[model samples]
Target: MLDLRSVEIGYGIMDHARNQGYATETVGALIDWAFAFASVEQIHAECLVTNLPSISVLEKVGMRKTKEVDDRIKWILKRNSVNEA
Candidate 1:
């Protein structure tokens, strides 16, 4: 079963939006909102191995690589608790 306290995020924009900072900004905002308003403990994102742009966006939002499998990579960012980094 799917965990209600964790969620995965994904997005894509039109060709005209490529190279703009919208993706990074939006992802960062979403993560911040999730941690602040939702009861979530972690957020996850994944992209194809060939999709460097997607990987960079995830990194910029403080998500670190958690695993690599086949042609894709997984990333995760956990809510920083009072006693944890």
Candidate 2:
């Protein structure tokens, strides 16, 4: 179970929309919504180690590496740690 103050986010983009910055924009918007409206204290995400595009999008949205478990890497973004777009 997740903590009440924390939320985990996940997203996927269509094959046709892969490299057009859609992932980054969607992730950022989600983060903004979570913190702004949900009153969440933190957000979390996980991506496969080989998924470089996903990793880049999480980092660009201000989530940092929190752990690594085999093939998956965990990330977290604390509230107030990012400037909303």
TM-score of 2: 0.91
Return the top candidate by TM-score.
2
At residue 25, what lDDT does model 1 achieve? 93
RMSD in Å for all candidates: 2.7, 2.0
Off by over 4 Å in 2: none
| Candidate 2 local lDDT, 38-81, one digit each (tens) | 66899999999999999999988889999999999999888877
lDDT of 2: 0.89
Predicted candidate 1: what Cα RMSD to the true structure? 2.7
Q: What's the residue-level lDDT of 19 in candidate 1?
A: 87
Question: For model 1, what is the C-alpha lDDT against the true structure?
Answer: 0.82
> Tens-digit lDDT track for model 1 on 9-80?
888967899789999999988887878756888888889999989988887788888889999998888887
Stretches of candidate 1 off by over 4 Å are 81-85
Provide the overall lDDT of each model, using Cα atoms, as 2-decimal numbers: 0.82, 0.89
Model 1 — which ten-residue stretch has the worst lDDT?
76-85
